[model samples]
Target: MAEKIIIGITMGDPAGIGPEITVKALSNPAIYDRCSPVVIGDACVMEAALTIVGKENVKIHPVSNVDQCLFTPGIIDVYDMKIVDINKLEYGKVSVMAGDAAFLYVKKVIELALAGEIDGTVTNALNKEAINLAGHHFSGHTEIYAEYTGTKKYTMMLAHDNLRVVHVSTHVSLREACDRVKKGRVLEVIEIANKACLDLGIEKPKIGVAGLNPHSGENGLFGREEIDEIIPAINAAKAEGIIADGPVPPDTLFSKARGGWYDIVVAMYHDQGHIPLKVVGFIYNPMAGKWDAVSGVNITLGLPIVRASVDHGTAFDQAGLGITSELSLVNAIDYAIRLSKSERIK
Candidate 1:
C-alpha cells in the first residue's frame, strides 16, 4: 500500500459552480483513499455549497496549514481564505470580489505546492473576464503556472481517455497562432509531448503532429507552413529517435488519433486542438435539456509542480442549479494524483 498523495484543490469563482462541484466531488469516499484533498477557498462558500449540493452531512473544517487537515472522507478540510461575503454572493453573476478571491486561491495553492506543502494541485473553473476585472492579467491557468514556477517552455495538454492533445501555441489569436508555429517551437512541443507521454508510462510513444493549414498546406498550395516549418520539425524529432508522425491532414488527424493510431497529437494552435477534444469530451442531451456529461483534464506540461484542471469553464448559467457534472473535476484529481505519484517516484 502507498501513502495517500496530498492534493490542494483551488475553489474557482464563487459566483460559479466551483463550490458546488467541490462538495459534490468530495462526497466520494474513494477520493480520500487515494489523496488527502483540501479546498483553498472561503469556508462560508463551501458551507453553503454543502447545502446546495445536498451534502450537508459533510462538514467543512478550516485549517490554516496542511498539517492541520484531518484528511477524513466525510469532513471537507478547507484552507479557508475567509474572503467571500456569503450575504452578497449571488450565483450566475460575476463580481470583482469573487474574481479576486478566485485569483488569490490559485496563488495560495501555487505557493503551497512550491513550498512542498502539497504533492499536486487541481483547480476548478474560474471566470476569465472576472479575473481580468479584478486586475490579475493571466490568460489562463497554464500561463499563471508558468509565470509562478519560472518555467520558460510549457504547453497545455488536454486529455479525455486515450485521445490526448498537446498544443504548440495556446491562448493566442488565430493569426498569431499560425505565426508562432515555427520549427523551433514545434520541435520544443514535440519534445515536451514525448516526455509527457513517457512520464505517463507510455513506452515508445507515437506522436502525431497536426499541420497549420488544410491538407497539410496541400504541398505548399494552400500554405507553405507545413513545407517550411512543420516538416522540418517532424524530421528533427524523428532524427532524435522520437516516434513522431505527420503534418497529417488536420481534418483526419483527430479521427486517426481517436482510432488509436497515435498516442498523442501535437496541435498547431489552440482551437485546432481544443475543438476536437471538446467535441469528444463535452456531451449534451437535447432531450433532457441538460448536459449528460462534461469530461476532460487540462494538464500543464514542463512545470516544476503538478497541476491539472477541469476542462470546462465556470458554468455561470448552471451555477447554483447543482446539476453540473463532477466528471471532469474527478478526472482532473485522478490525473494530478497520477502525475504527482510519478514525479515522486522519479
Candidate 2:
C-alpha cells in the first residue's frame, strides 16, 4: 500500500468549535488509513476540547516538529504552538488572544506545507471578527494564505456533493463585487476554476460562468456586464482551449450546475456562490433547535501549496455544547488528500 499523506490541520479559534471538531474527526481510526493527520495548535486547548467532547480514547501527543509525530491511530500528534493561555479562554466568546492563537496556527501549518514537511493543509473554522480584532486585518483564511504565499491571483471554490462553485470576488461588499467583475478578473477566475477541477480529477472541466445581472442583462435590457465583460471572458477562455460556457443567468446557473450540467460554476460574487452551497450543505432541524449536519469543503485555487477548509464558520453558539459536526472537516481532509496526491503526480 502507498504511504498515507501527512495532512497538517490548523485548529481554528481556540475558543470556538475548532478544537472540539478536530478531536472528534481524529477519533475515527479509518482516517489513519487514508492520511497521517496532525493538529497545529495548542496542546492544552485540544486537551480541554477532548474533555468537553468526552473523547477519552484519543491521546494528544505533543510534538515540536513534524518528525516527532508517531502517526498512530489512537494518538493525535499535535505540533504545539502554545500561543494561548488555556485559563483565559472561554468557549463561545471571541477575543484577541484566541484570534492571535488561531492566526499563528494557520501560519505555522502553511509554513510546514511550503517547507515540504507536510503534504497539504486543512483548516478548521476561524472567527473573522476575532482575527481582525487581533489586528491580523485579513478578511479570511483565503486572503491570509494568498498574501503569505505571494499568490497574486487566487479564487475560493466551495464544493458540496456534485455542486461546485468558484467565486470571482469574495470578501468584498456587494457593490464592490459588481464593480470588480471585469473581463480580466472574470477570465482569471475561470482559468483558476478549470485548473482546480483538473486537480480534483476532472480531465476537462465544464465551466459555467454566472452573470452579474438578471437574465444575463436580458440582452442589455437589465445590464451590459454580460455583453461587455462576461461574454468576452468566456470567448477568451474558449480560445485558450478551456471548456467554458457562461454568462448564464445567476438564477439558473446553480440549478444547472447542481444537476451536473457543469463541473464548476464561476460565480460573480460572494453571496452569489455561498448562498447556494450553504442551502444544500447546511441542514437544520427546527424541532431539534440545532444543526444536524454542516457539510462542504472550501478549496483555495492558484496557490503554490494545497489548502482545503471547512465551509462553515466558528459556531460560537454551539462551541462548548459539543454538537458541532465534524463532517465538513472530514470532507476537507479528503479534498486535501486528493489534491496532494495530484500535486505529487504532477
Candidate 3:
C-alpha cells in the first residue's frame, strides 16, 4: 500500500454527540488500516466518550503535528484544541463555551489543511445556534470553510452510495432562497457539481437539475424561475462541453440519479436534496427513539482544502446517549481519505 493518508477529524459541539461519534468511529480497527486519523478538539470530552463506548483500551496519543502521528491501529492521535471545560459541560444543553470550542476546532482544522499540515478533514456535527451564541456568526460549515479559505466559488455536496447532490443555495430562508435563484448561480452550481464528479474519478459527469417549482413551472405557469433561470443555466453548462441537462421535476430527478442515469442531481435548495439522502441514511428504531444506522457524508467543493462532514447534525437530545451512531463519522473519514488520495495524485 502507499503511504498512509493523514486525516484531521474535528470534534464538534461538546454539548452534543460530536465527541461520542468521534470516539466510536475511531474505535473500529479497519479505520486505522485505511488511514492515519487525528482528533482536533478537547481531550476531556473525548475521554468521556471513550469511557461510555467501552473502548478503554484505545489510547489517545497527544501529538504536536500530523507528522508526529504514529499511524498505529490502537492509537488515536489527538492535537488537543483545549477550549472546553469538562466540569461545566452538561449533556444536551447548548452553551457558549461548547460553541466556542467547536468553532475553534473547525477553524484550526481549516488552517491545518490549508497549510498542508494534514491531507484532509472530517468534521462531526456542530450546532448552528450554539455557534452563533459564541458570536461566530455564520450560516454553516460550508460558509465557514469558504470564508477562511477565501474561496469564492463553493458548493455543498451530500453523498450516499452512488447518489450525490449539490445545492445552489443552502442555509437561507425560503423567500430569499427562491429570489436568489438565477441563471448565473444555477450555472455556477452545475459547474461545481461537474468539476466535483471529475475529481471523484468520473470521466464525464452527467448532472440533472431539480426544478424550483411544480412540474418545472409548467411552461411558466406556476413559476418562471425554471424557464428564465434554470433552463438558461443548463444551456450554458452544455455550451462549456459539460454533460448537463434538466430543470427536471424536483420529485423525480433524484430517482433518475439514484438509478445511475446521472452522476449527480443539483438541488435548488436544502431540503429538496437533504430529504432524499436522509431517506437512505437516517434509519431510526422507534422502540427506543434513536437512529440505528446513521450514514452519509457531506463534502464542501471548491475550497483550498478538502473538508468532509458527517451528514447529520448536533443531536442535542442524544448528547450523552450511547445510542448515537458512529457510522456517519466513519464514512466521513473514509471520504477524507479518498479525497486526500485524489489530491496527492494531482
TM-score of model 2 (CA atoms): 0.98
Q: What is the alpha-carbon lDDT for the whole of candidate 2?
A: 0.93
Question: Local distance difference test, per candidate?
Answer: 0.94, 0.93, 0.88
> Cα miss at 22, model 2 (Å)?
0.5
Best candidate, lDDT: 1
The backbone clash count of each candidate, in order, is: 0, 0, 0
lDDT measured at residue 146 in model 1 versus the true structure, 0 to 100: 93
Better of 1 and 3 by TM-score: 1
Tell me the lDDT of candidate 1.
0.94
Assess every candidate by TM-score: 0.98, 0.98, 0.97
Writing each residue's lDDT as its tens digit, candidate 2 over 1-346 gives 2277999999999989999999999999999999999999999999888888899877999999999999888899999998989889998898999999999899999999999999999999899899999999999999999989999999999999999999999999999999999999999999999999888889989999999999999999998999999999999999999999978999999999989899999999999999999999999999988888899999999999999999999989889888888999999999999999999999
